[model samples]
Target: MGSIATRGDSKRSGNQGMIKTHSRSRHKRAQALAEMAVMVPFLVIGMMGMLDLGRAFYYQISLTNAVREAARYGAQPYYTGLSPACNAIPPATSPGASCPVPGDQNIKDRLAQELSGTGFVVDPTKIQILPDQGTRVSNCGTSGSCQYALKVTATYQFTFITPIIGDLIGNPLTLKTSSLFRTEY
Candidate 1:
């Protein structure tokens, strides 16, 4: 409600100067709306990027578990193995008599299959087993003297919600995990 208008004889007539009619600027309101619209996409993209990173981290963890399972199976010619897959590297038990398990490819394939069964898509071909990489030490006199490693490297494709990075980064993201441990056998 507006203040009481001053009468010719009003004592407070001097204060009337402060009162004014209400006015709204369309330009200012439009500018504010435009600014909000412009900032929203950037804010959304940032949030999506954060979400993508979290997914990547989770994938890495699951991939690690998958590799562990495969490595455990491949190690010691038995189960229950090491964290760093290298520890599980099949020892030169037979000294190159055509390994019973053949090469470490079986380990990588098993891991990929398990991961896929668990609803994870990964490239198993990227897996690298140091066990088949041959002995690290050259000219070993004894069969058990040399140490080997089993490495499982996996690459994954990540889908993004925001197109902000889609054009810039072709294809999905790549995540790799590897473990190395000594063979129990």
Candidate 2:
């Protein structure tokens, strides 16, 4: 009878230990769930930041190419003793307008148009030309070797998926590019 009693007690103790193990497992599962919920937002923010950075990089590249094109167009001497390859530019009176005759504005306007066609939004009004944006000396003027200038500015607004610091949303991404060249004038 004593041996039988001891065997029964051992079986009960084994079952009790199993019950405790199950309770501890349940607690662990709840902790893991809580941790996951807390970490989700940080993961989302990191992904959004990466996306924003990629867009910024793409816009910067587009701005750089726009400036290069504008400079190339300005380098021509056809209008003011500039090379024929020079892109369209306005007279020596206006420095910013794209069309002065149609009317011709400045070399920058034409370049902006071309670039915007490539899926980027560009506004010439946001840009400033130094010395003369619309003014181009004639082929006979003493302006010497002839120089063409083009400046471009682009801005992009990025919306956050999870704004950790919400107040800074109004600040946009800004890019500026300028091109200056001395072509045949």
Candidate 3:
């Protein structure tokens, strides 16, 4: 009888230990779930913000490159969109010659073509060939001869993929980039 009682008592003790372990595991799982519930939103938002930032940076770089390319093209000695009599500037001696610098409309069109699928459509009016400075005498070779400096600027409105980030900061950030170059021709 004493042995039977001792055996029964040991069995009850083992069952209690198992129940405690099971309850502890359940508690741990619930804790982990709660932690995840609290952290997942933040993690998701952070990831989204990172993505938006990357997109903005990429667009900025693309815009800068595009403007730089256009500026380089514009810097070449080109016509001033004038008639044949006034076509040649100091650099261009030949009348009605093909100038390195293209017309404003031409440059805008070329830039638009270059930025196709880049989500940018450059406006000709917005592109400044050389704002506040035009047809300056070239410091390059001779004082008599003239050289041109070209500057191109473009502005883009960037919209975030995630509206939450936009709400926090601001929706549709205006991104502007410019490129400056000296005329080679």
Candidate 4:
């Protein structure tokens, strides 16, 4: 009878040890959940920041390509007539005075067209044509002949989706790109 009572007591002690192990595992699980809960917001914000950065980079590349296209278009010779009358002009004559160069509005239109479908609201006012219209002239040595170059510049305001990061830095960051090309006339 004494041996039987001792065996029952040992069994009860073993059951108590199992309960302690189960409770410890539960506590560890709860601690892991608490840690995850504390870190989730930061992880989410970091992901959002990365997304915004990628968006900004995309916008910048698109803007750069648009500017380059606009510059290329502006630099090319545009002849409206069947025959190129501008090509026969005297070497001493100024190209801007006789040749038909692409106006600022035309360049802006090309830029806008390139930027279309990009989800960017391009302000026409933000586009700048250097040397303006009817002034495409650069003095070339002492020959008195003019060399033409077109420069197109555009600026876009890039707003981040992450408000915290935007606020920490500057909201609506200005992204500007410019392209220069010599005339093919």
Which candidate number would show the highest TM-score if scored against the true structure?
A: 4
**How far does residue 62 in candidate 1 sit from its true spot (Å)?**
2.6
Which candidate ranks first by lDDT, i.e. highest? 4
Provide the TM-score for each candidate, comma-separated: 0.56, 0.63, 0.76, 0.82
- Once fitted onto the true fold, the runs of candidate 2 whose alpha carbons sit more than 4 angstroms away are 1-8, 77-110, 113-118, 129-134, 139-144, 148-170
Expressed as tens digits, the lDDT of each residue in 1-185 for candidate 3 is 99999999999999999999999999999999999999999999899999998998888888788788777666654555554533545343431234444656666666777788787565566666663332432233443334455678888788899888888878898878888776554
lDDT (Cα, 0-100) at 157 in candidate 1: 68
Show model 3 residue runs off by greater than 4 Å. Answer: 1-5, 77-100, 117-120, 123-125, 131-144
Q: Candidate 2 on 39-109: residue-level lDDT in tens?
A: 99898887877776676667677777776666666555345424342355544333222332211245667
TM-score of 1: 0.56
lDDT of 4 by residue, 82-183 (tens): 345665642445455455667789899999999897989689999999867756643333455554667899999999999988987789989999998886
**Candidate number that wins on lDDT, 2 or 3:** 3
lDDT of each: 0.59, 0.56, 0.69, 0.82
lDDT of 1: 0.59
Error of 1 at 133 (Å): 11
Q: Report lDDT (Cα) of residue 137, candidate 4.
A: 44
**Against the correct fold, how does model 4 do in TM-score?**
0.82
